[model samples]
Target: MRSYTADYVIVGAGTAGCVLANRLTEDPNIKVILVEAGERDRHPFIHVPAGFVRLLDHPTVTWRYHTQADAETSGRAILFPRGRGLGGSSAINGLLYVRPFAEDIDSWEQSGANGWNFGNCLPFYRRSETWTEGSSPQRGTHGPIQVSRVENPPEICGAVVQAAQKAGLQFVDDPNSDTRGPSIWYYQQTRDGRRRSSAARGYLRPAMGRSNLTVVTGLQVSRLEMNGTHVSGINGTTSADIPVQIRATREVILSAGVIGTPRLLEMSGIGDKDVLDNAGIKTRIALPGVGNNLQDHYVVRLGYRVRGAGTANERSHGLALAREMMRYVVSGTGVLTYSAAIVGGFAQTRLATRPDVQFVIAPGSFVAGRIGVLESEPGVSCGVWQMRPQSRGHVHLTSSEITAAPTIAPSYLSTELDRNTMVEGLKIGRRIFAQPEVARYIVDETVPGRQAETDEALLQYVRDNGSTVYHAVGTCRMGDDAMSVVDSEMRVRGTTGLRIVDGSVMPSITSTNTNATVLMLAERAADMIRLPMAEHAASTYSKESV
Candidate 1:
């Protein structure tokens, strides 16, 4: 076996891993090795702002895992694509840069994640991004990630923004900073001009030259090397099936994301006893919450046929596409720079007191039940989902083999509140589309047409069509509860020299796109791990190897 040693071994060079690798390696003496199961983020499309559509199901860049068929989803197995390269999902995600509500961060402390409240987390959130609008009391000025407004939005998206205001929603200047009530606004993206500002580009790229940081791709970490209650390192095979062992002298950080993190723990015999037994793996530590509390935003889309204006469908093909490419090359503008959604915002349904539903409006439509493939005809679409879903699920292993896909059951729309919220959220979508500003551009509703107007009809439509927004979180949740997998400092419970810093550590799903929140989580985690012994918990944050 080929063996290597590092002060810290961070698995999964995704958003969280990229941040951790960059931050921890700041100390010249702290040798860090970042391992990724996928290839390097060198794909040309991975940098284009609009290329995410192509990257979603791409063979090498995504894992392409599918969720288990459940009653809540009309017994359909949904395609769940996860990023596989250095930047992980951030390289393939919609470049929307959105921060969660203060309440969302505060809820972590309420759930036993002490010191993780918004007040404590704000600095980290601010430290990760440089907004185009410059610095303010709530926004960051100089950070690694570059966040800017969606340039030259199409008329259809503007109409949606106007219609949303006409429908009684307030238009906010900066949605990320302001958290008042229901509001509509133009979306911002994680882009430095025309290129996507992924975590690999923002954080990892800057740290690559440092001798202390070693990034190894195409190595899938199968299991942790355990020394009693402490983790020593990890063992895995390269893409060519060559076995490799990376020993972490100080700490082994798991930043493998929501699905991958729990799967690693279970495979390493550190999860629930029943889960390990079923997977034919002997139990080590009985952390029942290792793979529980899976939360994601299940979205219901409403597609509309356009009347006069041309949408992305027309501009993305033929001579129009050529013009867009040329425009991008010359001025870095046009449809080539667009994100998944040109306009997005928060809104309230009749059943909620606050802005419970979020909207992702695009000037193009996809096939009725899926995304990525735009319709041949000119059209627009709006996808709405409950901002904070109460339903919980689990991700568990079915076999002991590391290559076998884990069973992901989100149990979407499993609760009455969840079902009701979705139903009403869809109704709110219809209302926004009905407003004269947007209605003038629409010929008619193409999906779940006007016939599906009633609450029962809308609920059925939601069950039949709702899909994931690609924001999976909370599997390896952090809290002080008996079932909690990690502590406030992100150290894995019941295990020394082990920690988890990723979306999986979120006690609850954030209120917006999860990429920004995941970045913030990793930023804070890096601080907790690198801070002086006197400033942090000496037991969890240690400089020397345990």
Candidate 2:
């Protein structure tokens, strides 16, 4: 067996892992090792902003975990694609950057996650961001991640923005600001013009050149090697099935994301005892919350057929492609650089205090599980997602063997509240499409058609075809409760020198995309871990004095 050692051993170099590696390795005295199950992020398509359609499902860059038979969707198994590379899901995401609402973070504090409220986390969010649209007090321009606006948006995208204004919603230039209710705005992407700016490209790539950081690819961590209540090391296998052990001098941080992190904990005998006993493994910790509280956003595509020449089909063929390519090559301004989802906004499905649904307007039809249906048809597609869902689910070990895939249960639409919200979101979508400004571009509804107008019909349609927005979180939730898997500082409960810093640690799901929040959490985790012992002592003394 091969053996290695480091001051910090980070499992799974995805979004969080990359950020942690970059921050921790900044100090030459701290030796950091980042292990990833997949190969390096060298694929060409991964750098293209619009190539996410293919990379989202590519097994080489994605973990490709599927959910168990969902109760709400008539036993349909949903595809959960997690990033398996150096940058994690950030490398293959839609790149719609959004911070959670203040209410969402306040809920985390209410759920026992101290020091994680919006007021406390706002600085961290700004710390990791580098917005191209210039600096604001709410946004940072010197951060590693580059966030920018779409240069040239489609006409329909603009119409949606107008429609949102006509609907009496606020139109804010920066949606991540303090004015955080409902708004219409141009989508912000993590791109430098046409090329993608992933966490690996922005953060990890620069840090990898340091002498103290070691990045190991194609290493699947099997279990945590613990001595009593303290974690000693991690055991795993290389791509060639070679056994290896990585001893951590200080800590073992699991940045393996929602699916992989909880799965690792369960495999290491730290989950619910009943689950471990069934898998024939000796119980060590028996934390029931290891794989509970699963949450994600589900979206139903609403497609429309255009009446005239204002669609992607007319702009994707022979002469059109040539003209656009020339313009794009000469001035870096064209439709090829960005995805069809140019304009999107948040809105309340009902007259509630908070926005419960989000809509993304794409100038192209994305159907058949992202195979891009109706490419030849002159139409646009709108995706409606029910945010802040009440439904919860779980993840569990399928077998004691490390090589076996874990069982995932997302339990989408498991609650009546979730169903009601989805149905209401569909109605809201119909209202937007029926508006005079938006109605001009549409000839007919190609998805559910005009027949499915009532609540029951919409509910049935949602149950049959709703798909995940690819934002899975809370499998290793952090809190002070008895069932909490990790604590507020991200340290695993009932253990020493073991921590989980990923989307899995989110006590509750954020109302927006999770990539930005995950990266920010990783940044905060790195800072917390890197604080000098003297500083920790001083801070503790100061708190006591207060």
lDDT of 2 by residue, 62-110 (tens): 8777788766887787778888887888888887888888889889989
- Candidate 1 TM-score versus the reference: 0.97
What local lDDT does model 2 show for residue 532? 60
Q: Which segments of candidate 2 are over 4 A away from where they belong?
A: 313-331, 368-374, 533-546
Q: Residue 442 of model 2: what lDDT?
A: 87
lDDT of each: 0.89, 0.82
TM-scores for candidates 1 onward, in order? 0.97, 0.94
Q: Residues 1-546, candidate 1, lDDT per residue (tens digit)?
A: 788888789999999999999999887778888999999889989998989989888899999999999987899999888999989999999998888888999999999999989889888889999998879877897888999998777777878888999988898878888865888988889999989999999999999999778888889889999999999999999888889988888899999999999999999999999889999999999999999999999998899999788799889888988999999999999888989888887888777778899999898898884678888889998899899999999999989987899999999999999999988888888888899998988888989888997889988899898889999999999999988999988899999999999999899999899999998999998888887633533222232221
Stretches of candidate 1 off by over 4 Å are: 533-546
